[model samples]
Target: MRRARTSFGALGAVTSVGVLIALIAACGDDRGGFIKNDRAFETQSEGGAPDAETCLLQCSLDGRSIIDSCTGGVVETCADDLACGAAKCQEPCAAAEADRSSNGCDFYFTQPLSAYPFASCFATFVVNASNKPATVSLELGGEELDVSGALFRAVPNSTDLELLEGPIPPGESAILFVADWDPTIPRSLGERLYHTSCPTAAKPAIQADGYFRSGIGDAFRLKSNVPIGLTWMYPYGGAGTHFPTATLVLPVSAWAKEHVVVNGWEANVGEPVTQIFAAEDDTEITIFGSKDVTNGVGFAGATAGMPAKIMLSKGQFVQIAQSQELTGSLVFSNKPTATVGGSECANLPSKAAACDTLAQQIPAFEQWGSEYVGIGYRPRTANTEEIVWYRMVGGRDGTELEYDPVKPAGAPTTLSAGELVLFRARSNDAFVVRARDAEHPFYLGMHMSGADGEESDSPSHGGMGDPEFVNVVPSGQYMSSYSFYADSSFSEHSLVIVRKKTHGAFKDVWLECAGNLPDWKPIDSAGQYEYRRVDLSRNFGPGDSFGEKRCTTGLQRMRSEGAFSATLWGWGKYASYAYPGGTAFRKLVEIPLSPVN
Candidate 1:
């Protein structure tokens, strides 16, 4: 999805009210202006200036400006071919091609699907509120779904979805896949999708890994003119008729460089894996405690100390594998990088043949907060208790620990660099972890047991009882309001966890549940914020499509008093998964307790 700086909000809307803004693309309108398509829509930022944000400068062919893009900015009349953009001028493309210096309509870029984790994969989309054709990435490899395929809302939910190229839309939803590798288009982006963590002037290009790779798993670079939510899944390994494994891939704008990865696989007693993809090149990365740091105690995949230093070219990546629990392993980079970590296949201590998979793109260190209030994950089977674990990263020598609804934590007076303290809890345990001081700002994550009790026959086939990872983020980084995507078009099934930023931060936690997710309850309230749990089912999922409904499987907003964060959960066939529903804008700090905006 192409999200431009417009009136639209950061995340897509909870309600589908029309938000249209006809902005032209950079091309010939001959009036010396840009000629854009109807697909353009603008969004309004919540705390931004009353006016919509200005557009980035695109040059004019004749070195002229039909209109200035922003107030007081340069009129930019350069014929520089190196100029990445141009105005959507009044002239037509056919006529503009005559000018050698013009960079016409180059904004129309396509994303190609290359290799994949499964022979066949399915993609479900949540289109931008913009009612344009951008319901999904227009290109899948070289093949494009019929533009009309986006109209899933008008189509009855009773229709067999597998037969359709995509769900119908007015910015509703859609599905796509590459049955084989042949649909490859002109490589929209090179080997990697996003740029490396380094800048061009600083080092070489570092490309990212494939969107859907086998052991490496799936990921997406959500760089779009129109905003949309995407969750792709593997057809096998799941229990029900639907695909088993699925996760929401955060947009590139949400990616970060440093991550305190928790190896959920360790809890399953299985080997753990973590993958780092460069957002920039010559990206010098240091992997602490992976193989390099802990002798053989770390990952088997590490190359350098192999834990201490990892040098990745633009878009390059390395998957760190470790047989032991990566107790407090840390990954740091000279610059920003994108990291994904989890177990390839892990079974909770049960030893079930059904070792389901787990993974999440870890957010950058900036998203880490000094405080965290955690709610336990539901156990996979009734009578079977869910084992929950918490890992605290980035605490210091003087770092103190505080807890509520308390349990036994050996509060240590000090913690060394790259050292993390781990805590384990049973199902439904409500607890809080806050560094006594901000100087020890840290992060928290949770791991739930595999689906041992989740299904009856699930273990006989592909996988069973796999542990899953969930990110409990810093409320300070949460969205004041945001929406989530449905896990499946079939049986309704969804749950979301939300917590307001500060005490009495908002009058109410939910604006509305969109009717589908009709149940909610206050879980924990003693901490700085209260957490409300919400649920939605197939009746509330993508069925009988009027389009996305309330509780689009998420919490929409908190009264403006403050911000809130969310994590969404969904299950299919036999597997379970969850992802942070909000975006992150982390600010790297050189010092602990540094003032963060």
Candidate 2:
């Protein structure tokens, strides 16, 4: 059901392309549907003189110069296979890389900077592996900030707010802030888009948490002088109507242009917020929607509807703001791109519980797996325990779908390609959601109860735990080790949950936060795999950064046998969030099952 992919005409008319996708466009007002992007050609240099043998330079189908044949500069990370050649060599990560735990990495693994779907409030921390001090810079909320004299110790309280307040140190460790920190304001961190709650280098160090608005859908970039490990959180503190606190450990350089579907939060009231980032300049993204449920060009594996087809360019982003329940929309891009989805705040069954914000950057279809263990979360709400719901999207009509431990009667057993379905489980129920045979590979996600909804008619998010979301980790993407931050805010802070992706049990499991994991009690029901919540908050204090742990929350590290899926959960006060656990696993490219010919 994939469309013609891209109009990928040659360069400009002065350029050479097959179809006429305006190499020069005006704000996507042209007929070709290419979003006008001032940054589109950033990665390509001007052409050099052509040799007699051949031009040696050719424009990519997407209308980009493959190798500045004119300048003698080849696109950065082309592979020996020639696959990573011209068309996809839009990123520079191929040239610079840092040490990694896993081996399958490629140019797309480690770069000096990393990109993630943006959120205004996140409890973030970092680790410096450089021997000399490192300076971390941030681009957020419409400002540029830098941190200085950063030192790292294998201990806690390594960072002091006073130290971060300025004449910053070099090569040392400290927590950075770029917020409107006005202690006088009650809705500072949670409600307002003030504190990224993230540890940034420094942007006018001590500022008060400002207005309630935030740059929620903006693309955020973190640049560092040295190879460093960074992690951020949509901590458990809920604001006004923002619900479902979540956490994600991004592989700074691990970005892909192709993503399948990232599900939304709650049901009726939950509007989907989609954020897409172009890794390379002048990149083109043609989004497809299964939710449209149509059959046409660009309608290949989709069914969702939208405004005239949308397009994107380098460094630019597109946000759906708040759209209809598009939890099942599909985005198809010609270049490597990154995506995240959820809601600014949402509730289930419209009248159920309170609201919470949701967000997660998901892997593309090529990276998706067929098996999953469904272990839901228990927020403070609900009478008994918690429930887990699965949003499954198929690629073919009548695709066979099933579950383990049994699903409710009349539950869905089939899916049409591009069809999206949200299936709810009984209270506190846990089960395995898989295809009858594995022919129909689909995507799945989980949700948590936003509020206790006990006796109060009030919407959930108030002092009740807000809704929580985390995509069901596919075993195929599982890694043996990961580097991340563990929130040290003891009260209601961040926790790590680990389980097998399928029937296989994993061994050699280890969690290192500050020190090695002292506890990992087995939890319940994730079907056949390991289930445990590891808490590292006990090892950190206010503004504390364990230098030994690279100044990150607890610098939690994990290693296990067999393929396992792990996720980090944020739960504190009335807010909470969740996201899949991942390593900086590198790859040559993140494309589709079928090449974009």
Candidate 3:
């Protein structure tokens, strides 16, 4: 089996279409029709036994004894003067020459060949003449590299598979064993084997250990093209069946499947084509179908107790026929609502109206894609009347606790403070968020200190006091935005967290006046005082040092209008960031949030 890209959309109960470019192999032009003769059985003598003289064939030109047969006590041999198999054996022959086909075709084998060295290389293949139904057994060793599926492409010119099955009349069935031992080589890529006895003319099936490696167990390796996200690992694990034109799954449960229409196109069952785009709470993926798909097909697989299997870690293996040409669409089962400002935040003026909360309506299958990271809007402070966008710079968990709250080396700064900066990065977690166009503005907010718990320090922020009014309270939830960026020097980085209000133990407070962001409407500008309870248990921080420490900002304004609308950016706990400049990026903060929500 081959490893492929992971899929994020509703893989089960879904039929995704794929397209592939054609591959051609070299041959003289005679693409078909080769025949086999009776010479294959000419060696047998009368009474179905070889005569003594007939059994003792000639040897090679050098006169060396060629092995004929080894009976109970006799070691029969051939003369060395004969050509081994390659030519008529008039005399004894030396070792047999490598096997070759009638049309000057040489035998070859294909299998993986390295130990995960991380490159594209060829696996070793060997050719031999063995006409038997072969059974291959694979065992895992050395770090256990994953295999997708194994297949054999038939040689273009040869008699029907019956020849490989030993003439197919009683004395038939000779199987050959081919071995592939490299971890870095790709076997099923583009090679074909020559055999006349292939059980059926159809393609062979591929198998993977996606579900139940042994008996029922719950451990599974994370699979995805996105940097960070986790799929539930039911004991059954993940798996998908293949079809000539599409990889379709009809979810057994009706609730998991969703239907929608976009741009006037409706999704109908069993259509030759279909397209779906990703939604905010769902992973950012597009699904296309080559044939009309229905829940009935997918439901059968799911009801059979199959794990919610999708494609592999990558979606490349899910091939679709090119003729179908599907246009897919994506819609959230639950839509996300944006929140605008009011008295909910202490730093804002009592009458200011510019904060927006872009909250998601968590769906049954909770998933989020962050096209941009650390993105959000916040006020200057509780005492000021202006709104600005504060972003996350460089941060770290240090795998321990430390104290200090200064800017880290290469940390980014706003060219103009309070000037809405459109920063981008993975969320504290690493979901992917995107914009329809670069010009469209995003929504924003900030955090502020509250009355009772506004004067203590936590270890997450370099042991320095947490952002004035925006301390991390044990049980409060805050909505924010994020952006990730790398500079030309390859040494600078940033992670910014902006919130509307803060209410836990912290060090200071600010008074900021605010207005709505420049070009967006609010879902509830008047009732903006709603409170949501949250537990950020997995986040890293309490340190105050900006360098090597988590960076944060409290409310910069109560309601300052801007040109962008607010949106939510979330990344699960384990996400990796890849800086554009070829430098490796790792998560410095966990965002301290619980998954219970």
Candidate 4:
């Protein structure tokens, strides 16, 4: 809901608004009991500004400044056509005004000399706004860019305001300031928040993943072909699904062959597991469950959506019944003395070579299976320091977890038998740390597709066709079609999904990281140059094929008004871009394939 404020004479002398609703009822007379006469009356009183010119400027009913007034104190009002403006003004006006009248919103940043060598830097303001019936335009360093609207609605009398440019409408907020770029690109080193519509208090309860960075360069020069693992720390425990802690004690050999290529690079992955030799104390809790060892029979594990049979499985390999592959890339370092730039890796030498010696690796395939396990934990406290950490268990597959608190002398708790034992992380970092998946003797970075003879300071990144995902277009524009598949085959009667409010000219999208949902970094940091893919597919009930070759109603409602939080994540391989009818395609290949296994 949108809220407006009214003051008496000063901004501090504010009064609360109360809306009084009125209701009326007809009087009825029975027999002749004092039913001689009846009267009707009604009245309404509300704490709102009066509808008059005086009310527009100083609000005669309340004495606050007319916030939405135009030049000459012309009162501006929000009607059906002003929803976006109304929403924008809800809190920003109050907050921006407070900022403008204060000591300023500049931050005190201190960094190592190596990271930022320049002596000093100045803050630049770039505003992009359209006054609608008025005008809007944008300029930088006295140069006019190809902006479409008039640019008059900027700060007029304030120096600080002049330094910061925009007064753009809420709709164009994404383009107000692209980035605080330096004219001279630094040889190396870089770094850089937004308001959440959700209440600040409520956000603490919402679990979030930390945006992890490995700090590896995009190219690697290798002398020998040794197995190097590229990893990003999860920082916490169980994500949407796939618990790792239960699989830890199954022996390291069990996970050696279970490698999977995430974001196009091979990763040695496995689930985290824990075990107990014998019941030690009553404070210890053990969770128990069983495995369904039906050969050649596969069903979807507990994950994000509906359960479907495995599209393909073999020996110990299971595929999600789709053609899209899940993968991540590797970055390489030039300094032989530095392992992946000497951050995550340990071993190093003193030489360098051409950056194309390393080749991308894919995981071997395995037939799917389920298992039962027991879990135990101790009580935890807020003061726990270093209480959360990630370690390697077996394969690249891992589970994020936290240490249980120490129970009293004799109060061990355990879950003995259950279909599945799910664990939840209580702390923010606990949810992301995967001890098993992150297990590696060392870390390394490399360019996956091979090396280009370009300098490290080159402006252009190495590859061009890194598979652009997540492309958001404006309303009424065409969205390319992508493929969709269920884990287990459904007879088509289980569910139906649709995209709502998914239209608009998206300006802040990270297009490079499309398709792979888990690969997406949170859209929080401003200067991060990454993108996420938007999967344009859905499911439906039996006999509900959209067409012989496609699923209908997939991208139809992308622009409707009811849409707000437009989010999509899934996986599949790219098919033909311009297929029949101009639709793009992504197909999930049959699992246990030769290239991956």
Candidates in order have lDDT scores of 0.39, 0.40, 0.17, 0.15
Q: Write the per-residue lDDT of candidate 1 for residues 166-212, one digit (tens) a residue.
A: 43342344333311111232334441231111111111111112222
State the lDDT of candidate 3 residue by residue for 1-597, as single tens digits. 333222211111011111110000100000011012111111121112222222333222111232322221222333333323322333211122111111111111111101111111111111111112222221211012232232222222221222232121110111111111123334443221200111233221111111100011111111111011001100010011000000001001101222211110111111112222111222222222213222221111121112222222112221111122122212222222110011101111111221111100111111111112222212112232222122221111111111112222222332211122222221121111222221121212222211112222201111111111111101011111111111111111122222221111111111111112222221122211112111111123121232342222211111111001112111111111111100001111123211111
Cα lDDT tens digits, model 2, 147-265, are 34221222443332334433213223333332223344456333354233323433422232221111112233556554344443343123331332443434334455556656565
Please report the candidate that would top lDDT against the real structure. Answer: 2
**Worst 10-residue lDDT window, candidate 3:** 237-246
User: What local lDDT does model 4 show for residue 591?
Assistant: 28
Task: Provide the lDDT at 71 for model 2.
Answer: 47
Model 4 alpha-carbon miss at residue 251, Å: 44
lDDT of 4 by residue, 144-257 (tens): 333222111222211111112343332111111111112233323322111111111111111111111111011101110111101110001111111000000010111222
Global lDDT of model 1: 0.39
Report the lDDT of model 4 for residue 238. Answer: 13
Mark the regions of model 3 whose C-alpha exceeds 4 Å error after superposition.
Answer: 1-490, 500-597
**Given candidate 1, what's the lDDT at residue 377?**
42
Q: Give candidate 4's error at residue 189 in angstroms.
A: 16
Candidate 2, position 539, lDDT? 25
Question: TM-score of the candidate numbered 3?
Answer: 0.19
Predict model 4's lDDT versus the native: 0.15
Report how far residue 452 has shifted in candidate 3, in Å: 51
Clashes of 4: 86
How would the candidate models be sorted by lDDT, starting from the highest?
Answer: 2, 1, 3, 4
